[model samples]
Target chain A: DAGITQSPRHKVTETGTPVTLRCHQTENHRYMYWYRQDPGHGLRLIHYSYGVKDTDKGEVSDGYSVSRSKTEDFLLTLESATSSQTSVYFCAIRGLYGYTFGSGTRLTVV
Target chain B: GIQVEQSPPDLILQEGANSTLRCNFSDSVNNLQWFHQNPWGQLINLFYIPSGTKQNGRLSATTVATERYSLLYISSSQTTDSGVYFCAVPYQGGSEKLVFGKGTKLTVNP
Candidate 1:
């Protein structure tokens, strides 16, 4: 709701292919996060950025990487898409009062 | 890292029923947020309560930071409320990253 947007709402990629999901925020938040939601695994953090060019791995960071070249854009890259990575990816920005999430991007690996 | 646990993995209720979803955190925190994910895979932030009580229409939340738990109460639940409810706490007190619970799935039938 904080003017956050996710691109490529849905995507299907071959295994071992590289895919990138973009999160753009008009508010220019400093903290951004990437999470994957699976049926039983819940929402697991993949990576998060505290500032431009500063990122850290989360609980499930393997196979995923993130980059924040600017204050309004955060990119999540799947190094080599796998079946396990097929799920809905959410991008969020930490707000002053709470966290705001994008519409989410659903990715499928074939 | 902090751990979050939600009770009643699934619940079914008639439209107009009232329900309480609970979240327990492993450590005390100054911030706890609640979210609702609809069937369309949109994550909506419902509450940013770290302590005390906050209400918005038919939904309200209370977080007891001292006790390390939070409660989300929904009154007169509607069919549109059928979704997954999640609670998250900062990784460590006020870290930028958040740890989320598996979530409580609510089904509000008419």
Candidate 2:
């Protein structure tokens, strides 16, 4: 197991509310990624960080934002949650061999 | 951006049966990986086969970059392997961001 943990494993929020999911990794990986999985969409990247303070958006990054102030923590925030944003989010840390993912965070917006 | 395709959007097999999942990439990729999303929604890394073949327990994977496809083999499938299997590839010269296939949903019956 890669020492990866996702905070607030489950969350329920109302639409228009702000939600933040945190991913923490004990391994000093240089690459970190945030992805969301929805029915029929598989897993789509939202944002990723190559190093502290260096981040980039992905295909479905329209309503999402990410920040990495330290190597261990990567955060994903939804400025205003929407019904469409109700999905399972996963955080991953890149390794030389492969990537290790967190347990995932299930967020539901109503 | 590269395109990734996964075959057999859904699969059903008995506990002792064997199966194979495929992933096709539209372009050359520098990194290729396979992941298994368990029932709990945790994504676990299965293999990082950008080329050649590799095996771990009852799971094995082979990627032929020349052919632009990868295959994952599950031998003697167990009920525990009954989630979704995703294949992700990083485009060449990219920032190590992975483009994921829609994934194959596997249902194992005892």
Candidate 3:
């Protein structure tokens, strides 16, 4: 939580526009993750990176993609933002203590 | 992938009260962590207990891996404790990728 930072704490975008959320970590943790939280679904994983340039899709990855070119940064992109994709997104890093999370980005699509 | 279910989906408690939250997984897991998402959407790590028990301040956690369940206890709750509690587990293999439960929302009133 202390080392991880999520950009644009709040964003309002058009339904068809593309959106990219950035996650930067000061801690050099190798594993990074992106997740979205909704009312009924709770938190669902979007994607994760085990190392720089090594990423994998999660259960709810269909509308999302991620890139990790550096150990300190993981970016989540929505190719085409949809109203349904409007939710709070969180970034996390695997640390010695456990998974440390970011403050989260609140995105709204209209 | 393991399935995580948290009980008492919504809880209300008076200040200084105590409560117990339960998490039941569909399978055995050696990696588990508890998180608290505050009203501001900041997720804070509470415990990284995979098994056994651990206590911090007024919060304690116990995980019985063999029984595929974990319990989180909060004592002397305060209004600041109002938030959503989550328990997450490894998705598969030994990866840090996690699958989270829907969450248990707690509202502590003064």
Cα lDDT of all candidates, in order? Answer: 0.93, 0.92, 0.92
RMSD of each: 1.0, 1.3, 1.1
Model 2 residue runs over 4 Å out of place are none
For each candidate, report its DockQ versus the true two-chain complex: 0.89, 0.89, 0.88
- Candidate 3's C-alpha runs over 4 A off are none
Give the range where candidate 1 chain B is weakest over 10 consecutive residues by summed lDDT: B90-99
lDDT tens per residue, model 2, A1-110 = 58999989999999999999999999999899998988888888899999999999888999998989999999999999999999999999998888899888999999
TM per prediction: 0.97, 0.95, 0.97
Model 3 residue B74 lDDT?
A: 98
lDDT string, candidate 1, A1-110, tens digits? 66999999999999999999999999978999999988889998999999999999999999998899999999999999999999999999998988999999999999
The segments of candidate 1 whose C-alpha lies over 4 angstroms from its true place after superposition are: none
Q: Please give the lDDT score at residue A71 for candidate 3.
A: 89
Go through the candidates in order and give the clash count of each: 0, 0, 0
**What are the per-residue Cα lDDT tens digits for candidate 3 across B38-88?**
988888999999999999999999999999999999999999999999999
- The residue-level lDDT of candidate 3 at B46 comes to 95
Error of 3 at B75 (Å): 1.1
* Cα displacement (Å) at residue A92, model 2: 0.9
